[model samples]
Target chain A: MIQRKKSLQCRHVDAGSCNACEQELTALLSKELDIQHYGIDIVASPRHADALLVTGPVTDTMQPALKKVWEAVPKPRQLIAVGDCAAGCGVFQKAYASHGGVDKVLEKPDQTILGCPPDPEKILDTLRELMNS
Target chain B: MSEASRVENPYNEWINDNISHKKAGDVWLALTGYRDGQIKSHWLRANGRIDEVKTACMDAQFASLTPSLPEVAWDEREIHDLFGYHPKGHPDLRPLVRTPRWPASFYPMQKQSDDHIEWTDVEPDNPAKVVEGEGITIMKVGPTHAGIIESGHFVFSIIGENILHLDAHLFQNHRGVEKALESLSVQEAKPLISRICGADTVSHQYNFLSAVEQLAGRKVPEMIEWQRIILLESERILSHLNDLAQIPAGVGFTVAHQRGLAMKEMWQKGLSAIFGHRFLFDAMYQEKLAVSKKEQLQQLLASFITQWHKWRKLADRQQGFHDRMRGVGVVKRDDAEQLGAVGVALRAAGVSVDVRTLMPLYRHNRIHIPQVTGGDVEARFQVRLQEVEHSIALIRNALEHLQGNQQDTSWSIPDDLTGEAVSYSESPHGLNAHVMQIQNGVILRYHVKSGAYRNWPVLAFAVAGNAVADFPLINKSFELCYSCADR
Candidate 1:
């Protein structure tokens, strides 16, 4: 059965990223790839969000903050990891302050997009897939 | 202890004299030591650009340089934070990167302390201080903001719509990157360094590789040097486009913002199709396959250039846009210099200090540097536009050279190299520097002083007296990185 999907109201959490993921994510809202036109938009608050778009290796200092953001989102919300750093710590694996990745602090992510910073097209495609499923 | 007496600390005395003579930019502190004895500190003084170094040993404590040079305060605090070196006379000795969450006595980078031990959270000290005045209100924003950007906290002391003062507290994104590199080899540490600031990866990687190459007395092929320049210029174009979009967005000019965004998307798409990563992060790590789509990339850029010119012309003619940006968030020339502003902030303030032009390394040393004296948001925006034009010319020149010849792509670093070296590159944001002390090819201590680190304080200066609503326009004009600053 196809999932009854319409629009996704996403809230992005930067657990401990290097700002690369933020740049590409910002590009998704640009004119060329208007993810909003595809019924996908990044909302301001977690309460209004249907999914959480997370980035970074979940630094120790940010772990609690990340969890709080997760709790703020309503039930049945999806968690999508957006970069190599979010999936498995990437280059900051052994960092003293980092808690490895998003999964280390939270449960397993529903979707993972991999790259140093995954391209906006790939991000858009993944979001489209997530919405359909 | 008199100025004339060359007593116990001769190096400190010389630094005092040189700073008194009004040559602050030329004065630098070089602290060197290997896992032993009192660290040898040197005052690297430059007289009319002629460099000289004088060494001195610490006697348990030293007079801080920040008393004379206000710009040196942050570096002094960083020194205190990292090596546990106390700066006796410096003001605001509060920890910068190491927040109050750690145990009171622990210094992560100091020798003999095992930094890998589990950290326990302590109550964080109030990040913002209360400003008492008639009708004064204080507001705190972020570590998590409404926008899709990195984390930073801004404390604004306001009266009605005007901002009386602003303080920025960063380091929310700090992940001990420098500490993480300590146990890794030079080859192993390259990946971590490149990601220091995602937009400026090419420049950061270049600085690290160049530092290692210098330490090992090795040289990259001339063609490879030219290739590095092309990549740097390409990255600059993409980053400038992002900054350019913010100016229009700040003023509610959606058409101009969208137009700039479209060009930026095309530029990234061209790079991705040719190089395989939109931001070209992969290209920095390995050799590219070949320039199979040279014509296609060229056509894409050519169209982008045409579109950019059209949009810029339209935006420039808009009276409302000019009125909004013309005099907003002005950083005077003196304030920019005193606060150690770099890149767009410095250049827009009419200060001619660029790392590429100052220390020429690339094949194309004749790159045009833009300067606008207004020191406002419009000045910064103008600087970005002119720089885009210059980068386009640079990329074309490098591409023309690339079409003529192909070079072998194989390189390696030897296992054992022991030396301390510093290298810098002109990143899109500003000068990105990497100083590494290597002991037997493994990093002993690695310090990254990014452009964001120097420029974050300057933003606080720019926002003062401006209306609260104009803060975003002013802040976006600088376009600094929180992670780079925090690291």
Candidate 2:
């Protein structure tokens, strides 16, 4: 059965990030590759998209907005946690004060692309995997 | 008594004399003038001074120290900010990374026996005169943007089109490294450091482990040392690649920038093949591949090198790249020095200080490292590309000498030691400096003065007089690591 692009809006959040993922995401939407290459469309409103391409770790403070965004993304929509912290909380998992990792917030990630701020390979790979299915 | 108290040597006395000291939460402290890595003052912490101006201090919050020793003040405000003591008369009280909301009533670094209370906030003095100043028009960017980079807002004050001042507003507060890292044992913390910069994870990891090893006074097997240098260099290659790619994008080289982005993915794919992730993260020196790092990783690396070489050739030949980069962000040698910039930013500006070469943390000291000088955006680009070349060569060297030794991989740290230790690594961006005050096998307070912070201020000077369009381009030339500072 086709996953049918799920019915959700995607939001990219920065969790103590240096913007590497943001830059790469913009490049995805760049006129060059075009988001259509991966069947990814930029929805102006979060209410319209299905997958949240969440980057960075789930911050203690960011928990409110993260929850809001996830809830805001519409139900049954999947959350794609990108980068190190989203999956395993990367380098920051050691800091005693973090809410532990992204899992502490989103118990089960719909999809996790782990990298130290993953490159387009991981991003594109997942997009392809989703679009194909 | 610190060396400051027992300074019989003339140089040490001079360093101790002009220095300031303070007692923070019952800990003796010393503030010494820093000169070319030498502390140039007789050090002593401030014992609450009566004449504020006489002591180069003005307000209750900060102390003034520049009038006496010139370059010494570089570390003063930083010392004050990180330690929560006073450089009492410091002319600049601008919180470095600590938000203005952070209260001075409590210090985070002062041996926290308990972090029980709700933290109080302090209000910043908003001046009545900020709206209009000569040659200053405030221009704010972010917490949102056109490019895909990290989140944070930057408010730039421009005089006409030139950026006269820049206020970096980063409170993305993921510092939860001290917090995030708590559940992790040394085995896990070892790999997490690699993710700190995303670009310099290997370098960060190496330095982190090296610091831990130093704390424990343990040495890795000579073979692991060799493996570390190789991984460090591979990490350097991609880091520089990202910087090269970003510079073009910053300057509106749409096609060139996209190509750079695509090119980065290719290199990352090369990394992913060997390490199972795009970032080559996780333990590259897996127990099975530990001794055979050179044999296993090197073979894999050699396969990628051929592809990378071709990509480099294509990137180098791109006229559009040449057009966009050339002389943008020209950090002249004198300016670079006074700013005390490190890494490729310094090298591009003609200051050849590579921590890998200057203060090698491991095999870096033993191995031969390459050096370059271009001092411009193009120069930084050239330096990075050449270093990537050198990195490949160094990895090959590691492979030839790759041995399997588990001695260094043991993730053990030592018991409490209140003394201070400073560790410097040549991160892909530049110098990553970490100062640790350890107690009971835990870091009491780890103060980081990363290359990002050093290069960030100088960026304002570089962007000055340049067109507003060039701001992003100029900024990318350095690609300063924010994680180091954001932490």
Candidate 3:
């Protein structure tokens, strides 16, 4: 018998904005909205995760923590920008505090889902898309 | 005062003796208690507020309370900010959501006043204390977190996996919702309050309408009552379903999270079919929104509820789902109280305090909801599942009860001033209280206390002892909304 390994893992960095995305992103694994079927786990330790799911407009104040998490995650890891705020700062982009957008820093993202709070299914599908690629 | 006899107004003789409007200086209104699911009753001081309290007489100070009067006393500073009347020895005089530089000469509530352009810099609240020298590093999460949830920051000190101390850095830029709506008419202001917390819009609207009904001394039609209950239940089911899916994602149980999404979407779709949006904001009440066919809409809602129950049954039986959520993060009863947690978090900790039961309101008194206690992350998870099930039962009962009741959705302000009123309802997070003051057909003052003010801090405490890996797990157990606190 052969065991199949997960395609990728994620360490979430809450750069700025409220915790809605953090809750929704992590909640992807509950019995109600299972993300494991898609082979993704939101690891607390950056070193252990294969992907970095960065949710934020990445405010100036949180830049150090954001970059530190990115540095901590080992090489060859991809980035998944989940939520409209992360993708393009969403509703909060207009605010003075924001660091523009996630793309402004991360440069390239493996995926992006657009919604003030993106739907859970959209998140699962993004991981599935990663697994296939 | 005989046992079975109608008691006459004992104040009749008192009112006749000294009922004259004279020498009333400025009416000072201070909403003392905002969050704890209790209304912040304004002092309603006619001349000197202190003199009125001494002369007019009021009853009740606190009830099974967390002594949160100290914690939430910040609102008093706010009352002072906009009204210029001090809380007579308010303990903390620091800035709370407003500028210290706000002109002392002008108060926002003083009819016409200079608008202060901004807020004073928020002083970082002192983190919860922990004994020094234990290799416990203090790690602080934000008023901001990743993704779309509301804002709040948690500072955690941990000795290895054991949490040493937890304090939440709260009230990060929550626009003053309740305070701004004080001047709106009853019909004009329902939607504004409803949008206070996006997730709990239904409950907020319902709470206001119920309070309005109480204040107006008007009888709400049976149909409206039942319809409101249906909307409330729809809101509850969708919210709990949302919570159910959330638990697994926190700790990396993707399968359960996915299952939760489908289940939640199913519930949301049923709601969207009945009311336009899946979140069920406008559906909760007919607040000035024109409804052409009330009977047809009711029929549509009736059919949707039947389908929702069936869909939920299939979703609950997903395989390997429960494994991810059996006993993840646990908050003891003592800890839950100290941290001032509420809703499913408190129930999971075995406190058994639901606003509907602890403080019965509307049709909640008609239905009986059994208290559930598991006292862990899984317990919190189970509580929500149970609540969804309970919501189903309550919805069914409300629909049946609405058969011959009349519902008057049309609302108007009272022609004569009827004083002020306070209202409360439990939002998804915990207890939500609205302190409202009205005079001359306008909401003179509005102050809100959303439950998240207490829950997030307690959630920080609950996470102690759990592995850092489980921070999100413990977090979702409480699911404290920073936005609610910020607001």
Candidate 4:
């Protein structure tokens, strides 16, 4: 297990989402949540990220990209699967185009936030815990 | 088939006269022309009055309709990719939904194809069309972009910062949602339908349920219709507000961007308080709104309008904001009409085409379809701002209609009701249509052609001739959903 850090820099990889999780993730940037204040930043590049925040049931087209993204993230990285789809493919289970979820492609995520789309607060809390732990 | 025995399809005539004679998939092709009011299939199909023209896919190849119907180009390409129905003369028949990784022989939508297939890791040749010439720089943008956005690959050919052409290769988020919905009961498919596109959840749900209800021959109660209208409008408000926020962000107007997002956040919280989901997913399945919740919504909308007016005043005062938007990314009216643009993109280009006007629920109500003539980022922005106000008015009106109307909200599918129908909803992006075919009370074939899918190609048109720096602003102006389009 990777050591807990003071801050977490996450690069979001949308393997194959309905974009609900991304919506909530975008909500984290709102003044109400302002996750940046908590020392957790959703960076642009995986190379600069300490964690990979992945959403969606991993699609066949996205699997290779997801793997490449994971590899691009530097060492001591945590993979947090956001939403039910990322956790276990949700309604998309066994669908032809998808590899099911993040776990199927990137092995197991370090943490999973469950909900059709976990609320902004839940996502923030999970990141906060990851930072502290 | 002899002409004497052949039952003449009015739809065929409608297509021939209005749209195209390309005998590919008439019903499927009609959706592309839907926003222009040139095609009418939803109500007729719902009433079981329209005869579907079915073409046999002999040798898995069909005549391309793209030569005649430029609007149905994407539909034909998608058909080629998913169902293996080759559009023989399709102008640019590179893979659409199918990326290079997907095996050439495997068609996911085909009934005989296995649900799971071995994926190839080998990087194949880039099938994306490249414009090579002197003094032309090719900039390839992401399937995964820098921002918290959905995946879509864009190839821009530029001559000294001015975009010569843009080839947007989308469907990176093709999760086979339609295929997954097949064989599932309407009830089971509800969740997936709502999840098809998060921002357009209510729109997708409205379309899917409308199709299901039409197939089941169930007349939804007025109260439920009003409730759905409120949900859909609320969703519209949220969606438009998001685009509103992003446009300013693209132009680096920090104050407007932050303020817009804050306002949007407030509305999201309000929606969550009333509907249970921030993005309003599965909102239709919720019980009828209580009087208290209705009052809460009224207060929320009232406050939002006040705040919106204040923001609009501030935004209007900022000449720089207007300067950045005005004359940037202009999609001409003629281009918009010919390309079959919908919603803000179409309306901004001076075409007063809104699917909501066609919807029976909104027809009785005072629905003002907003339009502007500029066809630029500013015009689209203005259209959205106007739409937000209209949506608020619509919600308030719907609330008034719902008050004291304690009608039955419960609905069930008729036993063994098996049929196919098309339903359209005017989503914030544009017109979203769902074609559902059922057998034995379960989905046999489920197809969704979202607004984003139709408008995506229009973005390529809008972006060309604009500086690469303005691409984000132009893209944000359209605000097409990648996942929705891909799905």
Stretches > 4 Å off in candidate 1: A1-4, B1-11, B17-60, B111-116, B122-126, B285-297, B403-411
- Model 3 ranges off by over 4 Å: A1-133, B1-134, B287-329, B334-340, B358-371, B402-411, B415-418
lDDT string for model 4 (B1-487, tens) is 2454224532234334333322322223233211111222232222323344333444666555466568878887777777777666679887777877877677776654455576677652247776789999888888777779887778889999799999888877888888888778877888888889988999998988788778777777777788898899999999999999999999899899989998998898899998887888888876466444888898888888888988899788999899989999998898887787888999999988776765786866877877589999999999998999888888888888776755564666766868878777889888788777788887777778888888988999898899999998999999888888887
| Per-model TM values vs. the true structure | 0.92, 0.75, 0.64, 0.92
Q: What is the TM-score of chain B in candidate 2?
A: 0.77
Superposed by TM-score, candidate 2 places the C-alpha of residue B57 at a distance from the truth, in angstroms, of 14
Each model's DockQ score: 0.63, 0.32, 0.12, 0.71
Off by over 4 Å in 4: A1-4, B1-54, B113-115, B124-126, B290-292, B405-410
**Per-chain TM-score (chain B), model 3:** 0.73
Best by DockQ: 4
Tens digits of lDDT, candidate 2, B308-414 = 67667767887777776777778888777665566787787766556564444353445333454556677877887778777777777766776545554455455
Q: Which runs in model 2 stand beyond 4 Å of their true positions?
A: A1-11, A18-35, A41-52, A58-133, B1-83, B100-106, B111-136, B174-188, B252-259, B282-290, B293-296, B360-374, B403-420
Candidate lDDT scores, in order, read: 0.77, 0.57, 0.58, 0.79
lDDT (0-100) at residue B326 of candidate 1?
88
Quick one: RMSD of model 4?
Answer: 4.7
True contacts kept of each: 0.61, 0.39, 0.12, 0.72
Q: Chain A of candidate 3: what's the TM-score?
A: 0.87
Model 1 CA lDDT for position A130: 86
